[model samples]
Target: MKTKIVLLPLDERPCNYLFPQKLFLHDDIDIVLPEKLGDKKIPAGLKEIDSFLTKECKDATGLVISLDTLLYGGLVPSRIHNETEDKLKERLHILKDIRKANPKLIIYAFNIIMRCPSYSSSDEEPDYYEEYGREIHEIGAAMHKSHLGMENTLPLDEIIEKVPEKYLNDYISRRKVNKALNLASLELVKENIVDALVVPQDDSCKYGYAAIDQRDIRKAIIKNCLEDKVLMYPGADEVELTLISRMINTLKGRKPKIYLKYATEAAKSIIPLYEGNMLSGTLKYHVLSAGCQLTEAYEMADIIMAVTAPAGNMEEAINQPSKYPEYYAERNIAEMFDFIKDRLSEGKIVTIADNAYANGGDLQIVRFLNANNLLMEVDGYAGWNTSANTVGTAIAEAVDAYHFGTTERHQNFLGLRYIEDLGFCSMIRQKVVERLPEYGMNYFDVRDKEGKISELVKAELEEFIKNELSSISNNLKILKLIMPWRRMFEVDIDVKYIK
Candidate 1:
């Protein structure tokens, strides 16, 4: 049987839509992502997405969709859009039509519990974020703490007492709109319009809108007896991947056995920045959420996950190693590597979840893999923006390995991971940040004075990226290196040899 899974991503970002499709590209299963809405922009792609579903989604075996895309055009527009409640509700009714069309499809839809970023940059949020972003988060956090019955909940009181009433009302009104939409989604799940639904709080903190949103969603889920089908948690981008993985395994009659390992014991307790929980807790949630079980005995596992994380607070590593001492610390990786080396030799798939430092992989670890010629030995490698990002993608790769892993394809995937995670994020990005100053622009604000960004860094990026990739992949061709977000924060590299 040919398994078809249609994905309606929150946006055209590679992580959001591309990674899941890549993971689903095995022998019997096919992952189909509808044509991206626009040229990676927002508020205009809904017609195209709807057209694809109306035309091409008939035979799909399963669907993993983002409601943000269906209603508000994309995730970004969901936050910044000025549409009214009546308009949003009218769009929400489309789910009923979709269900009437494909009643038998195993539908797992998700909606993000909107986030209040620490610093409002408008890069992906509303325009008022720059001046009032932090304050808004602080106010939400304070209210959240009080709801939790915490004693030190003075911040909320202070904000309510001090801040302008208009700004506070504006923030509250927007959150109210989002919360209503989330409930409407849960209603869809309740009515069997969708099989399962997730409401993940993106960029969460302890006492903020994220906490409050989770609390409300949890109440609704329990009230409606929808615990088995509806879920609420602290995650954003990885939710789609988790849902896809679950559906894939359920359809295939397989529950992947994963052996999880951490870089250091200390790393488990310390939460990486931009997340809500400890690294250990987050990994546990993702493992089970993906319909995979964690195992203690390494020998019985289908995939060995060796997570590389910081010994202390994880941060972006600059050239100075002494400042980030965790990078230099020998966390007994030698023994771990040897164990993995033995497993690979014995035909077990070994994968690395490199959270050694957020936003990049540890150069020490990358260099270690390169020097020992273990690049090909490791079945998969993922070190991207966050530990959740790395772990989720690596899990998808491991599941793919269990079903469709090949030596050529395995090395090809690793080739792309190393070039992007190791080359661009850690090495080339730093070089670009340093070089940008000479051009009279700050590293963080590298866009032109007119807010336009140039692809001038491709020439400089290709030199080092190609040199490093040559050391790793002989057959793989580095087709292009372009910055998707126009900053050094992320890269969108194209490789032709993977398929």
Candidate 2:
């Protein structure tokens, strides 16, 4: 079946983190985007999601569109002043024309979490927006906080209380404009423009934290809206649940009950690794193909240990890094490596079932794994990096095999212990580190910055890439061809200086 999902999410920030590329691609779900929404300015070689969504999709069975991008105050180009009722009508008309070209299309719609602009130390809305971000943030915070007593609930009068008397009336007028935009998107259901509406509410929407509380909100939304008529549910842009459901629905010919047994055993070990380490985690798999990476983590475990047992601190040692400016911490990759290595030693296999690692830098990590022979046996997807849930799933799979030990296959369980160095670090990251000392340098300030460094220190740092870091780039290219799927596993190893 051909499904066409026309997605317009709340600017790139919400969509990328919530509905990661790996999670969507794993289920063969095709994501479609309109051209109006451009890239969110991610740096070199990283997969620009807007590029893929807007241009790469093929014909599909359903079209899921996010209304938030259209009405969201956070999106870069959403001009509420310019986007009057007539403009919205014209936009909808264009979308309707596109759908007419696709005969077997069903629509799924999503609303944005009313978000206050998240800020940073340097200043306004973290490099994306200008003054408008602050303006909208004040308005959004007011609207979301109106009419309800709780921290997360709405209290309408609060909007009036907060803004100055001069701007209060104008703020109310703009809020009405945004609310009307939201209503118009929802009204698509009534007009038959879309089949189903998914008004998702994640932690950010309700609790002010950036997470989707799946059990509480998803269940409630399903009961209230998705129960009858068109399907409506609460899920953040993080499409884990929705993708999993689609995979389950696509399943054909039945298999033995042992598969379930293996899955149950696998879940036991893997669940603990991610208890609170990540914002959220959920297990999902395509059954019948033990070839499936999720299953491979279970089948390959050799020395599964008992419950609550202490594995080494390898989880803390290895890191899973991203090139995006937002995730600047260098320890991320080291921590991930530590977690996976420790678990594998305890005879736990790893399956990062939920969070997908999307950037090119992530793919490099896979090469590091394949070089060590851990990629094939350790079991995980390139798009899906190691989150705590995935780490725990690996443990569960190992434990299940430990209890049912046949003993002969134990030797095949390759030792995934972390070694000193397998060779991979982000090149762009190297450039960033080398340039750090030059941050505030002007002619007058040159002595202040350069006086601290010895001649030896200056020379070594200057030659960092030409002599020291050049091998990283060379190794990455060679590894890319041999282990194309391993890119996500690589991390920049500049800690020698970063620390």
Candidate 3:
């Protein structure tokens, strides 16, 4: 009999659903994803997804779901749609029904602590966000501080002084409605409808309205004595994979023992922009969240993780190396070498989180690993978006690899990780963007700014990716690079194994 799981994702992003499905694909395990309601489509899509769940998945060993998917259709829909407050609460019935139908089945679900957009951008936000977004975000930050009994550096009068009164009112109104809905989900935990809950704060900062709401939710969790089962932290994209890992652990009746080594001690405190708290705390939370344990002694580790950070204070945002001082940070690179070699030689399954840069991998780290022929020795690697994104994703995949993985599939996955993080994003994306102006196009032409990149630009990126990733591995071929959403914040790789 197969160990089955039904996963409802936050959105249709390939990374959110497809990657985890692939990683959990074993002869004995089955991961099922229901059809999605198109982005921004609400009640109808939600009904369809729920109906599918009711009809299709009954005997699965566990279910991993996103409340955002059920209530709002997708994560973005949760933000942009104008669903009424009462109607939103009505949807919790679907989960209650699932629980009634399968009383003994384990359920894992996640709810997002919605993001506060930084700029006035309607791309992923509501229409008015393009103008008052920054002010609205700051207001939340100031309000968060006040709730915590901390001094607000910026007075509320000054924070929203420039915004139109109507926009501020509407924004606050929306936040209140959403916050109410999030709180209501806590009741589901009290009712024992969900076995575990993940509330990852999207686009978090030290202080904000979202942070303040998280405090309230944290109190509720404690009040219910559901603290161990509900995992809330500062992350967004990678929670599905993390929970699936935990689900797998539950099914297997085992915890993954892991060891962690960072490039520098400061690497532990370097707060990647979108999260609150230090990097070290987030990592420990992630490990336990995945039903994995961190070992005090390296000898006991089933897997070893080497987290790479910049040697000095530098952010790896752009490809222009000279624009930032400490570009390579050779000191950190040397440290990573010793770390990886030390662990790998000890027969520990090693994974790398090359966070020396953000929005892409550290080229210098990849360059060193490639030059020294240590790239293939590692079990997994992830260098996408923020530190939590990379760390959560890399750790889940690495833990899975340590327990259940094949050489061919693992190599193919690692190749895909490097191809995206290093080959395209770190290097080729900038190259192709540079060529866009020749076609009267710009970087925004291929990125999330405007919807659906031009076919010409897409074609150009495909050609460049082939050149960069063609020789990545003998076992995996560069099948295709796709913009699943037709914009380039994230791309999907169609990897075909060598026959």
Candidate 4:
């Protein structure tokens, strides 16, 4: 018999919904989801979700849920929701009822500690955030420092004066309600209503509103003595896949041993952009969360993870300088590739976490792998978004490959990462964005998702693969491409290998 697990994704994005399904395509497990998950800013159908859960949990061996979706309809709505505390609490009570109805169901849940981006953009935030987002972030950082009796570099009073009193209050009030819900989720763990819970800090920094909330959430976990049952880390979109890997491991009574290989020694300590902790700290949480252990003995390892992190400051892939900098001199790409080759020779499942840059894969690394005809040799590869996102994604794919062995789906997933992460993000995205103005379009609004801009993207991607990745491009073809939110930030792609 196959294992049946119902998933409530963080949102309708490809990362949250499609990635996990593709990862488990050939496995003896089934991932069931509700039919109507809402769009970018539109909230999901709460009644549909409630009904789906009630019906699906009857015989399901496990349930992986995003509390943000259940409580506020989706992740975006969680930030701008104005529902009263009583109403939010009423929605949360549904989980307890589900637990009561299915006493044997193994429930793994996650909630996000909302992020405050430093830039002033209302793309995924409240309308007023377009004007006050930067000020709000600065004020939160200043207040957090002052509360700890630390020096404040920001002009705290001036920044506060810039934002009107009403906007600040509204932001603070929404945070309070969300924090309360986080605590409520912890209570479910204490009561055994939830078997395990993860609270991911999305796009976090060391000192800010998210970090402050993280501290309070930590206190609650300690107060309740739920350390083993709860985990808080710097990630968002990848947590569900991590939990799904953990669920499969638990069901099969397997805990894979992973051996880490960094491109440079300093890669472990360098903190990537849009994150709070060092690479090593975040890796610890992600590895353990995926039900895998880090091993020092290579001979005893079930998987080898080659992490291509930065030797210095991490920048966006598109903004990288043509001439390599002095700080990156220490990253030995040759040695990393040789190590992966050696591991594969020894029958080890080697995976690459290409996080040398933010928001995309390293072009140098991709070129090297393709040149050596090793693009399809690795078991897994991911370097799409944040460091945590990349690490968690690689870990999940590696875990799945280790247990079930790599299949055609796995190879296609590896190809997808190469085309999307390295091809589009690093090279083609910028080229196409630069040409968008000719079509009277912009990054946020490309007019139509599959219109001229997407066609331009497809042409650019195909030409890129033909020139840069000739070894694998002959066998690979793009089946479908669409900008999921009608934006240039992310894309939903379908790729297949032709015989």
Candidate 5:
């Protein structure tokens, strides 16, 4: 018999919905999703999701849900929702009823601690955030410090005077409701309605509104003695995939052991941008969340994770100097490449977690892999978005490969990461963004997703692969490419690989 798991993704984005489905294609697992998950900024139909969960979960063996979607429509809507606290609580009760209907279903759920972007942008925030976003973030940090009786570097009163009272009040009000929802989800774990729960801090920092919420959530977990059943970490988009790996491991009674290999020991202590904790701290939760253990002995490990940490401070892919500075000169890529090579020779499932850059893979790492002809030899690779996002994704793929072994689908996924994470993010995205002004477009508003901007990107990527990444060019072809959300931030790519 095959395992059937019903998923309610964080949103309708490809990372949340499509990635999980593709990962399970070669396995005996059936991942069932709701018919309609809505668009960016637009909430999915609550009635449709509830009905789908109630129906499909009855026969399913497990359920992986994003509580943000169930409580506030979707991730973006969670930030701007105007629904009252009473109404949101009423919606949360729906989970209890589902548990009643499917008594035997193993429920795994996650909720996000709302993010506070350092820069001002209304693309995924309120209309007022475009103007006061940075000020709002500063104000939140000041307030959090004041509440804890810490010294305030930025004058809170001065910053607060800049924004209108109404918008600040509105932002604080929504955060209160969302934090309450996070606590309520933990109660589900205490009640055994949810077998496991993860409350991911989305795009977090060391001191801010999100960190304050994380502290409160941690207190509740300890207070209720639900420590083992819940995990709070610095990740958002990749939690669904992590839970899916856990579910598969549980079904097969497999707990894979993973050994961490960092480019430099200092990389473990350095906190990547947009996150609160160090890379090592987050990796522990990610490994455990996927139903895996970290091993000290390489000979006893099932997966060898080659983590490419930054030399010193991490920088965005576009801003990196053509010749990196001395501060960014500590990473020993040649040594890391050799380690991967040696592991692959020993028939180990080696995976690469490229965290050397913020928004893309390290081009140097890609070139090394290509030069050594190890691009497709490794089991998994991911380096996009935040460091936690890349680490969680890489760990999930490694877990899947460990259990199922390599397959044609696995090879395609590996190729997709190289194309999107390395090729588009590091190389093509900057080129496309530069050309956007010529086409009367900007980064946020690319006009048309499949128009000239995308065509330019496709052409540049083809040239880049042929010239730079010829190792996998013959087997990989771009089947489709579009700016998902019609922005230069990310691209939705479809590719075909022969081997």
Candidate 6:
């Protein structure tokens, strides 16, 4: 019998962009989505999500319940808020109600990810909240305008002082949300409301918010819940999606082991690693960003890991525009190279991809990396450095473009970060999970350090590769390799998109 799974993503953008729809491409899984969840509305109704659990998911054998989606109104905001007892309690009641209706169905739930609340503008403006107090006041005014339509913008200082302690308290409540979600995940299991929990490995979610470390809180929740069934799986979004899909394919006839391969060729254009004196802070953010370790130390290696940000003027590269003139003149490539070549004498491998954001005299960064034998690129679409989104649709299109052959679609890019540290891994994992049914793999449960995942998630990852590796040649390998490397580790490269 075909396995039927239902996925209710908490946020609209992530729900549509990365989820089961993309995950099931490699499998024959039948994934069901509620009509309300699909509505163009920004916030998926709580009632709508609950209706699916009671009405639609009632007959399904297994279901994945993203608590973040079910509560907090939306995904980003839910994670972006401050946690409090009241707020946490409010969301938990909703989940409790859903579990009361279906005690037999296996439910996989996740605690909401905590994130610092901040906003960005597409115009490339500096994140003003860090620089000026007025920008924050403006935000408060906008909020007031939206809710109360107050005239005469309140004085910035007045608003700061007058904003109700309650409202401001709610705005910055990470501690409460963390506690609430932790308690809910455990309580649900204790109450037998959920069969398993799937916690994603997302620590940065709280970096911008309060000082609380969610890692510890999640571990405690896992211990309190039944350890046998409450598996604490370690996976990001991208990894989760792939793992989920792998589960489905295993049930199908796909083989269980595979290796990733790159589709592009660069015989004549190999970027040789520069073997000379290494510059402390020169030759690409790709290289500079990776400088957390000893620079002189890396020069001695056969391969060097680089982290280049978007292309920009050597001026912008050397100094922040916010501090332009003081350090601006130091942006000379000749001067920068003089210091870098000395370290290159030490054998190193420099990985790179030209970022599109830097303001520079020319695209010399890639040329420099190439001239010095220091370029390795990963395959994937990458326009944003910190905000890389895997265009699953684009990847699907690329797959179709190549007739499922990695070599056919040679035009690709490398990831700036390593696989393990990438934030986008979760998104990719979500997509992979959504696609499981087609491959006949059943995700009995999925969890991370946060919750129902066992310590065997890595084994599960290996199992996934084993199952789907042969189905599409090295497609999974390439996707898995490129997706995380660029997102987590920094490397220098020649040009942004090799394709």
Q: What is the TM-score (0 to 1) of candidate 6?
A: 0.43
TM-score of each: 0.89, 0.43, 0.91, 0.98, 0.97, 0.43
TM-score of 1: 0.89
Stretch of 10 with least lDDT, candidate 6: 259-268
Give a tens-digit lDDT track for model 1, residues 1-499.
7788888887767678676755566667777877556433357466777787766567788888899888887787778666677778777676677778877888888898888887756567666676678777877877777777876536566777655778667767877888888988988887888888877767777668877877788898999998778766556677777888888788879998899777677788877766777888888777777778899898889889998776777777454243666655746677777777888888898889988777777777777787777766677788877777778778877776776765454555667787778777777777777767776776546654223233554555456545654454555566765555555566666654543
Off by over 4 Å in 5: 321-328
lDDT (Cα, 0-100) at 164 in candidate 1: 71
The segments of candidate 4 whose C-alpha lies over 4 angstroms from its true place after superposition are 321-327
Q: Across residues 73-100, which tens digit of lDDT does each residue of candidate 3 receive?
A: 8888888767788998998888888888
lDDT tens digits, residue span 1-499, model 6: 5567666664443323243453243233566666655322245666666666667675665566666666654554454434456665676675566555555555666553443333432111122323432343354444444444445445445645644555455444544655557556777778777765544433232122221334455476656756544433222233223223323433343322211111111111222111011111122211111111123344343233222332222122212232432223323445444434443454222222222122111134434544553322222222222211121111222222122222322332231221111212322233354654654443432322212222122334344333322222133222222221111112112111222
Q: Candidate 4's residue-wise lDDT over 1-499, tens digit each?
A: 7789999999999899898888875557999988879887899999999999999988899999999999988999998989998798888788899999989999999999989999999989999999999999999999888889898886689779999999999999999999999998998998899999999999999888988999999999999899888999989999988999999989989999999998888878878899988888889889988889999987899999999886777888887642455235878878888888999999899988988888988888888888888888888899888988999989988988887887888777888999999889888998899988888888889977788888889889999889877889899999999888898999888988664
Clashes of each: 1, 61, 3, 0, 0, 118
CA lDDT scores, all candidates in order: 0.74, 0.34, 0.75, 0.89, 0.87, 0.37
Candidate 4, 64: how far from true, in Å? 0.8
Query: Could you say which candidate leads in lDDT?
Result: 4
Predicted candidate 2 versus true structure: per-residue lDDT over 264-349, tens digit per residue: 12233332221212121222221111112222343443332211111111121124443432233322444555555676676554
lDDT of 2 at 15: 26
lDDT of 4 at 314: 84
lDDT of 5: 0.87
User: In terms of TM-score, which candidate is stronger, 1 or 6?
Assistant: 1
List ranges where model 2 is wrong by over 4 Å: 1-61, 68-74, 79-82, 93-103, 118-176, 189-197, 200-224, 227-350, 353-475, 478-499
